[model samples]
Target: AARIIVIQKRAAGKKWGKIMVQWHPLLTTSIPVEQPKGQGIKDLWEDIRLPGEGYYFREQRFGNPGQTSMKLTERVIIAFSNPDDVILDPFLGSGTTAVACKRLNRHYIGFEISPEYCKIAKARLLAEKTLWD
Candidate 1:
């Protein structure tokens, strides 16, 4: 069985309590913690951020074994890229990343070895409607 764990919030300083979250590959079950010190994208390590930085969408039924959360992909893409930027996804599982890029008006190039996922991604991309449209 596949599973994911998330640490949703943390308490701030010793005297004050403020909920805080640090964007990363995994979220733990910690508490109101200290606020992150840097911009989210700037905090990316070696320009790479791990997946499952947020909720894992336990309800999702379509994905490969290692598929990342759509919410996480969207957040990462938006933080690290712009409307005109060309996003590249080598895995292209279920096409979440490509769809996110289209929704955000960013161009994308993806590659997927699996035919099923490729079909899904193609259909998703073809069915995508631009925000302005």
Candidate 2:
């Protein structure tokens, strides 16, 4: 449906990087003012040439073999989009994209080829700790 695609390096030695995002209809990326002091989303793509750390779950990361790092995904989502924006992930691996979207208050539609991965991703999303008290 929608499309908000982001291509990133898998790692330093890896021959190929990963195409991580895909949005629906049409999505626009805008740089906003009033950010966290010196740090702004403007610098989000500054180090795009480097390798992504992949998911933060480490040993806990399962189901999908190619899980993008949570921090990297979150950073991209925060920079390229705003809260309430919709994200589309065609290859919904470990659901890192969905997790990032949820944490950032963005809507998402994730598609996965494997039902097993889907279930695993769902559990991970539900297991996420809320920011609210």
Candidate 3:
């Protein structure tokens, strides 16, 4: 599946993110599974709105310029991985990937170069942990 992020700002081109599926033939058994009915996800997603500077600006305040919506991250995670699967995120901006992994019962390793974003990611993960406790 592919998600195209359309920003509302003028002159901003559409941003693209994709889930790349790879497996060694005869060695890997991973395959995409069917999502439950009425999950609102499609092969081509065009309806998920980007967080703007209005009511949805709460997520953008973390100073991660490349922040994405949690819904999008969750959908991608669900499509690509199974419960308890280990996922690796090279850029852990704001901890969206980790939070989604926690919510979906997956283990994740995330790396961020900026200390500020690292702090934000840890806080977000902690918040998610407390939610289930």
Candidate 4:
């Protein structure tokens, strides 16, 4: 589900308590699969391979899963959003949104549920300069 909200400058550190979501787009593909009658294993995915560091950030500079691959994020942001546009990711994770925004000239704001993730996000954002420059 994806929802885009366009807003003029928002107050700093002020959280919008509750938001009423209007639309939710289905995120699954149209692949037919059967489910068991009882509580059992569900084959939601046909193949599963444990991801390595490359899967997350593609760099060992920071050994963290929360930080996504900068290249991957940059590609997605460039594809979906444009420069100077407001992009929001409720689950910010490791500040991937911020890094991509910085590189693409877009404005982004997001929140991380875990303080650890937040720290990781901060580190990831800080590390962007070194990676890009």
Backbone clash count for every predicted candidate, in the order shown: 9, 12, 0, 0
- The candidate that wins on TM-score is 3
Q: What are the TM-scores, per candidate, against the unseen true structure?
A: 0.57, 0.59, 0.64, 0.49
TM-score of 1: 0.57
Error of 2 at 69 (Å): 0.6
Off by over 4 Å in 4: 1-57, 61-67, 130-133
Per-residue lDDT tens digits for candidate 2, residues 84-106, read 88989999987989988988899
Instruction: Report the lDDT tens digits of candidate 3 across residue range 15-92.
Output: 457332221111223445566783643444444444433334334457777777787678678876889999899999
- Which sections of candidate 2 miss by over 4 Å? 1-59
Better of 1 and 2 by lDDT: 2
Best prediction by lDDT: 3
CA RMSD per model (angstroms): 11.8, 7.2, 8.9, 15.8
Q: Who is ahead in lDDT, 2 or 3?
A: 3
Model 1 lDDT per residue over 1-133, tens place:
2222332322232433544344433432322123347433223333333333333455454667667656666766665566788988888888888988988788999988999998888887788787676
Per-residue lDDT of model 4, residues 65-127, tens digit only: 455456545644654565677878898876777878987888988977888778987887777
